[model samples]
Target: MDKKSPSDTAEFNISAYDQAEFNDLLFENMPDYAFVKNDSFKIVKANSAFLSMYPTNIRDKVIGYTTVEDYQPKEAELFLARDKEAFEQGYSETVETITFPDHRIRTLLTRKKRFEAIDGRTYILGIATDVTEREELIEKLRKSNDDLDQFAYMASHDLKAPLTAIAKLVSWIDEDHRSELPVGAIENFELIKSRINRMTQLLNDMLTYSRVNQTPHEKEEFSFKDLVLEQFDMICIDKEFNLSCCELIVSLQKDAIAIVLRNLLANAIKHHHLDHGNIDVTIEEKKGFYLIKVTDDGPGIDPQYSSKIFEMFQTLKPRDQQEGSGIGLAICKKIANHYAGDITLIDQPNGTSFLVTWPSVPTQQPPFKRIK
Candidate 1:
C-alpha cells in the first residue's frame, strides 16, 4: 500500500479539529460556571468561568483538589452530599447561595449529572447559573405588595369608625327633629343617611379586597346548595328573588367560593329591572376545572363593558345609580386566577351569564352529603 501523503493526514483531522476547537471555545467563554469531578470527588476540570470565581491565590490549586477546604464545613458537607446523589441517582439539581472570592454573594441554580467519557472513567458534570438579581427583584416586589395590603387594611379600619359615628348622628337628628322639620329637610336627611351607608359598604369591601389573598385557600367539603342559600339569605333580606341551583357536594376553598357566589348573586339582584328575577347557578367538573355558570334574567352587560367589569373599582353604571364598590368581581377574578382559573362573560340575547372556571384538585377528604 502507498504511504499516506501529508495532505491526506490534514484532511482526516480537519473535522475532529473543528469539533474540539468549538467545544473548547464554548466551555471557556460561557457565562455559567461549569466543572467536572471524578468519582473520588476531586475537581479534575473547570471552565474559565469557574476559575474566575475563586481568589487568585487558590485558582491554580483548584484543579486536582476538593473545594471542601475552601468552603465552610456545612457547605462542604452539602456539596459532597449533592455529588454523591448525582453519582448514585444519575442527576441532581438545587438552588444555592454562595459568596465569591470578591465577597459578592450570588444565588445560583446548580445542576449536576453523571457523565461517562470515552476514557471509561465516571465523572460528574456541573453547571451553575446565577439568579441573584432575579431573586432580589422577586423579594422587593413581595415586600411592596405586603406594604400596600397593610396600608389598605389600616386605612379602611380607621375610616369606618368615623363613618359609623356620622351615620348615628344623622339618625339621631332625624328622630329628634322629624316633627319640627319640613318634609324637604326630612328627605335631605334620608339622602345623607343613604350616602353614609354607601360609604360604609365601600369601605367594608375595600378591606375585604385587601385581605382576599392573605390567607391560604384550603379545600373544604360542604353542600354547594347550602352555601348559596346562606349567602343569598344574607343579601336578599326583603327582595323577591328566585335562585335555582344544582344540588351537588363540592370540595373547594369554602370562604373563597362564598365570595364568588355572593358577588354574582348580589350583581344579579341589584341590577334586575323588576322586584323579582330568576337566577340560576350550576357547576360541573370539567377535566381539571370546575365550570360554574351563573345566569340571571337581568339586563345583560353590554359587550363593551364586559371586559371592564372584572377590573378593580370598574363599574359600567355610576356609583350613585348603582351602589357598589366595584371590587366584587375583581375579588372573584383574583381568587380564580390564583388557582389558574378565570371568569368570563358569555354573551346572551337577553340575560347575563358569568362563566367562572375554578381549578379542581383531588378531594383530600370524603365527599360531603348534600342537604335536602
Candidate 2:
C-alpha cells in the first residue's frame, strides 16, 4: 500500500453523509420529543424520541400522516391550529395536556418554529418537553404544606382549652390553700403560673403565624396615620412612647396589613431598653413599592442576628428574659412574602430601623376561596 503523507491526513474532510448521520444521532438521543411537519401539519420527519409516543410496532405508520389521522379529532384540531399559528406568526409555544397513543396523559411544554430547510422547503420544527412529573410533584408539595398548616392550626386551637383549665385549677389551688402552703410551695405555684402564661402565648402566636396568609381579606382604602392609630389602640403600650406616622393613603388587604403593623409595633414596644422611647413610622412611595420605615430610639438588634430573627422560633434574647414566642417576625415575613414584598432591618447608628417594602399592588392574589 502507498504511504499517505501527513498533509493528506490533515486534509481529511467530513462528507455530507457523515454530517447527516451526526444530526440523526443527536435528534434520536435528545430527551425531548422532536419532529418536523410540513405546512399542511403532516409529520414528514420524526426522531426516535417522538416515535416513542406510539407503540413500537406502529411507530413506522406515524410518518407522512397528520395529527388528525393519529389522534382524536378535537386534540388534532387544537394541534393543527397551533401549528398553523406557528407558521403564520413565526413561532408558537404552549404548555398543554396531551394524551398519547399509549393512553398515558402528560403535561408538555411544546414549542414550534417555522424554518426553511436546505431544499428551500418551509417546515415547522416542533419540540416537546414532558413536565407531567414535575407538575405532579409540585402539587403534592402544596398539598403537604396545606395539610401541615391545618394540623398546626388544629393542634394549637385544641391546646388552648386544656391550658386554660390548668391555669384556672392552679389559681384555685393557690387561693384555697394560701395560708396552708409553705413559702417554697407558693413560689413554685407562681413559677407554674408563669410557665402556663408562656404556654398560652406560644399557642396564640403559633395559631396567628399559621393563619397569617391562609384566608383572604377584602382590600380597603385607608390612611397610614389612621391605620397606625387603630393598631395602637389595640396594642395599648404602657410606656409613654411617641408614635409618629406619615400621611399616606393606600389600598390594601386591611386585616393582613394590620397584622404586620401590629406585630412590628408591639415588637418595638416590647423590646425597648428604655423607660420611654420614640417610635416613628414614615412611608414613601417608590417606583413599584411603598417603603415603610419604622424607626425606634431603643436598643437596636445585633446585625449578626438580623437574618436569623425572621425564622420561626428564633429569638435574639432568651425567652425568659424577653417574653416572646419568637413567631412575631416570622409572621411578618410570611405576610410580606405573601404580597410579594419583604421586611428588612436597615442598618442605623442609633436604635433599630426596620424597612418594609410593600408592593403598590399585590403580585399574587391570595389562594383562599372568595366568599360570594
Candidate 3:
C-alpha cells in the first residue's frame, strides 16, 4: 500500500466531508426554526418546526417565496433593516421577535451565513436559537437589582435618624455631666463617646457605599496622574510614611477615580505592620486594561481570611487594633465593580498587595446611571 502525498491528502480530506454520514445527523438534531434564504432574501428552505409555527395557508404560500417584510411586524422594520445589512455584509446573527399566525409571538435569534451551493446558487443559511427563557431571566435579575437598590436607600435613610440622635445625646452628656461625673463614670462617658463615633463613621461609610451606585457620575476626561499626586500629597502631609515612588499617570473620571485610589491608599497606610513601613503604588497599561497595584510592606494577611477582606463589615482585626470602620475595602470593591473592574489580594511571603484591574474606559455606562 502507498501512502498519500500532502496534495493528495488535502484533496481526499475535502472529498471525505461529502461521504461523511452527516446529513442524517443534520436533520436528526435540527433547530426549531432552521432556515435558508437566497440573495433576494426569499425563503428557500425551512425546517419542520418553522412550518408548524405558521398557518397552513400562510405556510404553503410562504414556502419557497416570501420577503422579510411580508411576515415581520411594521414596528420591527428597524430589526429587518439590520438583518438585511447583516445579509449584505456577508452574514450576521440577529435576534428578532416573529408573530405566528396564532397571534403568539416568538423570539428567533437567527444567525445568517453567506454560502454558495454546488449549483452556484448564493444563499444565506440561518439557524435560530430560542432565547425567550434567557430574556425572561435577565428581566427578573434586573427587577431584583432595582429592588435591592430601593432597599439600600430606605435602610440607609432610616438608619441615619437614630444615629444622629445618639451623636447628639453623647455631646449633651459630655457638656452637662463632666463636672459632676464620678471617677469611673467619666470613663463610661468616654466609652459612650467612642461608641457614638464608631456608629457615626459606620453610617457615613454605609451611606457612601449605597450612594455610589445611586449617584450619577460626571466623567469628564482628566489626568489620573494629577488625581494620584493630589491624594499622595494629602496622605504624605497628614501621615509620616515612606511613599517616595510617586509615578504620575493619566486616567479619566477625576472624582470617581479619586474615590477608588483614596480607599486603597488609606488601607495601605492604616494597616502598616512596621512603624516606618513602605507603600508602593504602580500603574501599568496592558491590552486595554489599567493595572493599578497598591503594595504595603506590612504584616501580610492570613491565607484563610484574604477572601473576606472586601466583604462589607468584615475585618480581620478588632476596632481597637486598626480603629477601622471596616467599610473602606468594601467601598473600594464597589467602585471597582462600577467600572466593571475587580480587586484581589495577593499574599506574599513578605507582605500583602492589593491589586485592582479596571478598564481604561468603561465599555458601557454603569447600569445604575439611568435610574432616578
Candidate 4:
C-alpha cells in the first residue's frame, strides 16, 4: 500500500477481472445459444449468440424479458413448458423447431438444466445448438432415395415389356426361319439370341439391385449350415466342386442372408476356370460381427481389381468372355451396407477368398476388428 509497483497493480487488476468475468468470457464466446432465466422464467442473462437473434439496436431489451415477450406466442408456450419441466425434473433436452425474434425458423437441439448460483438463487441454464442444416440434409436424402426407388420401379416395369416382346420375336425367328437361312446367317441369328439373353439377364439383375432394401423385413433365427445348403440347392454347381459350411445358429433377416449367399455361391462357381475346384464356406464369430469367408480354388482375382469389384456394373473379365451381369458383387455390398456390414475380397495365395462381415445381433456395437 505504501508504494505499489506498476507491474504488481497490473497483475492484481488482471486477476480480479478474470475471477469476476470467467463465466461471462466462456458464455459470450460459446458458439451455441446460451442463456440464464430466473425461477419465474424471466431472462436474467443472455450471451452474444442469444442476443444475435434480435436486432442490434434492441438486443438489450431481451434481458429481463420472458420468452413469451420475445418470441412467437406458440413457440414461447412450448419453450416455457419445457423450461418448467426442466425446473421440476432438474434437466430436459429436446430437438425442436423454434422461431427466433428475427422471424427465422430454426431446428435446435436444446438442453435446459436447473442451476443454483453462488448467491443461492435458483435459475435455469438453457443452451441450444442449431441443427437446421443437418436435419434438412437428412430430409433431402430421404426424399431423394424415395424418388430413386419410384424411378427404378417405373423404368424396370416399362423396359421389361419391350424386352420380353423382342425376346419372343427373336425366338420365333430362330425357330421358324433356321433352315431357310445360310450357315453364317444361322450363326448370326444364334449370336443375336445370345445377346438378347444377356440383355434379359442384365435387366433382371438391375431390377434386383434397385429393389434391394426397399422394404423392411423382420429378422429371424436360422441355421447357417441350412441357409448355405438351401441356397446351394437352388444353383446348379459342378459335381466336382464341393460347398460346405460349419454348424452355427444365427439370427438375421433370413431372406436377405439367403440372397447374399446365393450371389456369392453363384459368383464362385461362375468364375472358376477349372472344372474340379473346392468352394469352402466357413463362418467365424468375432467380437461384433460374423465373418463369412467364401474360399474358392479358382483363378484368383487381380489385387488391383479388388476395390473396383464392388462397384455397380464392374467386372474383372470381359463381358463377352464371361456370361455375367456384373451386378452380383454390387448387390452383395448393398445388402451388407443395409445391415451395417461389409463385403470384401481377401487376398489369398491360390484363389479368391471373400469375407462378408455380417453385423452381430443388436448391430449397434463398435466395428469388428478388421482381419489383415
Candidate 5:
C-alpha cells in the first residue's frame, strides 16, 4: 500500500473541518447554550448565540480563555471540585447559578465525558440555557391565575344573597297576586323591580371591576387629558354637581396606564361630594410622568376612612348615601399595581384630593410605519 502524501493528509483534515462546521450549523440556531472545554476545564469553544446571551461577556471576552475562573471565578472553584468528584466517581454532575457581575446568574447542567484526542489531549463538553425570564413569567402567570380564582370565589358568594331575595320576591308576586293586585300595588312592584335591577347591575359591575387586571387588554397610545375630558363630558349631564373646567395636560400610555386613568376618573365622578358644590380635576406633567388630581370641594372624606376605601367592599358611607358597589377604588389599586404605578390621597380639610402618578411611556418616537 502506498503511503498517504502530505497533500492527502491536508485534504482529509479540511474535510473533517467542513463536517465540524456543518455540525455547528445545527447548534447555531439552538436556544440553549453549548460549549466545550479541555480536560483542565479551560473553555476552548462557544457557539455564536451562546456568546450573545451573556451581555457581560461577548465573544472576545470568553473564547480561547483558560479556566472558567477567568470569567466565572466562583463557579470555577465549585465546578473544579465537582469535576474532581465526577472524574473519580465516573458520572456526570450538575451545577447551578454561576454568578458574575451585575447580579447576572446562569444555571448550568454539565455532562462530562473523558475522551482522548488523536494528539492525546482529553476534553469535556457542557450545555446550558437561560431559564430566568421563563421562570419569572411562569411565577407571575401562576399568581395571576390564583388571584382570578380568589375573585371568582368572592364574587359568587357575595352576589348570592341579593340574587336569592330578588328571585323569591318575583316568585311570590307571580304566584299570589299577579291578577288581583290592589291599585298602587303595581307601582310598589315596579319600585321593587327597579331596586332588584339596580342591585344586579351593581353586582355584575363589581365582578367585572375585580377581574379587570386578570383580563388581557390591547395597549395603545391614548391621551390622559382626552380620557379625563371625556369623563367630564359624561358627568356634565348631571346638573346636581358642577365639574369645573380646567386645562388638562396630556399623558400617554405605553402599557396598561389606561386602566389607571379609567378607574381614577370613574371614582372621581362616582364619589364627588355633591355638598361641596364643585369638583376640580387637575393634570400636571412633571419629570417623566403625569400627576392626576381629582379634588372634590364636597364634604371631605374622613382621614380615618381614606385608607380602607381601596379595600374590596369597604365603604365608609352606606350604599344609600353613595351609589357605588365599593369596587371602583379596589380596581383602581389593581390596575395601578399591574402597571407598577401608584394612587394615593393628598391631605386636605373638608375636601379630598386623590393623586394618581403614572410613568410616561416614551412617545417621542413616531408610530411604527413601514418604510417605503
Candidate 6:
C-alpha cells in the first residue's frame, strides 16, 4: 500500500491540470464569450461562444487577429486603449455593443483581467456576458414609469380643473332653482356632488401615489402625537375621531408619514360602526425601523379580503353605501414600500389594526415582517 505525502499530493494536483482533455472540456462548455489575448492584443485562444461571433469562413482564422477592423475607427481606438489598460491595471470592465459578422447587434458586459502563465508569458483573459435583452427591458421599464408620471400630472392639473368647474356649476344650479325643483332633485344633486368629490379624491391620491417615491424623503424631527393628531383633524373636521397615543419625538419623512396616517385615520372613521370611536397608535423604535400600529374600535375586515384590500381602486363596500376613492390604503402601502418599509393589516377578532414599518432613513433593504 502506498500513500502520497502532502507535498507529493500538492505537486500531483498541480501537474494533473496538464491533462488537455479536462482543460478543453472547461473552455468549450463556458456559457459566456471567453478568450485569451497575447501581448500583441491578438486573440490567441477563444471559446465556442467567441467563435460563434464570426462567419464560418473566418471562424478558423479568428485566432491571432485583433478586433480593429471589426469595429468603427473610433471604437477600435478606444478598444485598443482599454485592452492596454487591462494589461497594465490587471483588470477592466465595460459594457460594449458589437455588430457580429452576421450583422446581429448585441450588448455585452465584458470583464478583462491580466494573467501570467507558468512559462512567464503574459496574457489578457476576457469574459463577456450578453446583456442586450436585459438592457432593453430596463429601458422599457424606465419609459413606463415616466409615462405614469405624465398621466398623473395630467390628471391633477388638466382633468381636475374641469371636474371642479362641473361641481361648481351644479352648486350654482341648486342655489338658483331650489324652490322650483322637484322633491328628490335635491338628493340627486347631493349624490352628484358626492361622486364628484370621490373622483377628485381619487385624482389627488393618484398624484400622491405617483409622487410618493418621485422625490427623496427628507428626514425631520417632530412629535409623533402631533403629526397623527394633525392628520386626524384634517380627516375628521366636525366629527370626533378619538385617538390615544403616547407622545414621543420622531425623526423621519414628515409629509409622507402624515399622508399614511391620514389615510389610516380616515379608513377607521369611514368604516366605523359609530360616528366617533377610539383609535390607539403605538410607535416604538425597532433595530432599524419605527414600528407604527394603528388600532381602531371598528368592525374588522375579513381574512379573505386582506390581500385584496391593498389593491388600487379596491373597495369592500358599494360606492353608494360608502363614499370613498378606495385608493387610500393603496397609497399608504406605496409610501411605506418607497422607504424600504411595509404596511399590513393585523387580522384580529374585535377591531381593525394596521401595522406599518417605517425606516428612519432611506434604505434599499426591506424591514423585517415580524408583526402581531
lDDT of 5 by residue, 64-110 (tens): 76536444676667777766654455445454566743346765545
TM-score of each: 0.84, 0.79, 0.80, 0.85, 0.53, 0.77
TM-score of 4: 0.85
**Whole-model lDDT per candidate:** 0.87, 0.86, 0.73, 0.85, 0.65, 0.85
Supply the TM-score for candidate 1.
Answer: 0.84
Model 6 segments beyond 4 Å from truth?
1-15, 18-23, 37-42, 56-66, 73-94, 113-124, 152-158, 219-226, 242-252, 284-290, 359-372
- Which stretches of model 3 miss by more than 4 angstroms? 1-28, 55-58, 67-72, 75-79, 114-122, 181-185, 213-225, 235-238, 246-248, 361-372
Output the TM-score of candidate 5. 0.53
Q: Could you give candidate 1's per-residue lDDT for residues 130-176 as a string of tens digits?
A: 98998899899999989998999999999999999999998888888
By lDDT, is 2 or 3 better? 2
**What lDDT score goes with residue 350 in model 4?**
83
What does candidate 3's lDDT look like per residue over 184-212, in tens digits? 98898788778777877787787788777
RMSD of 2: 7.7
When sorted by TM-score, best at the front, the candidate numbers are: 4, 1, 3, 2, 6, 5
Q: lDDT, candidate 6, residue 350?
A: 86
lDDT of 4: 0.85
lDDT, candidate 1, at 354? 98
Q: After superposition, how far is residue 238 of candidate 2 from its true place, in Å?
A: 1.9
Candidate 4, residues 199-316, lDDT tens digits: the string is: 7888788888889887776789889999998898788444567877898998777898888999998888888897667788999888878999888888999888999999988888
Which 10 residues in a row give candidate 5 its minimum summed lDDT? 363-372
Q: Deviation in angstroms for 216 in model 4?
A: 1.3
lDDT of 2 at 180: 97
Pull out the clashing pairs in model 3. Answer: 224-251, 225-249
Better of 1 and 5 by lDDT: 1
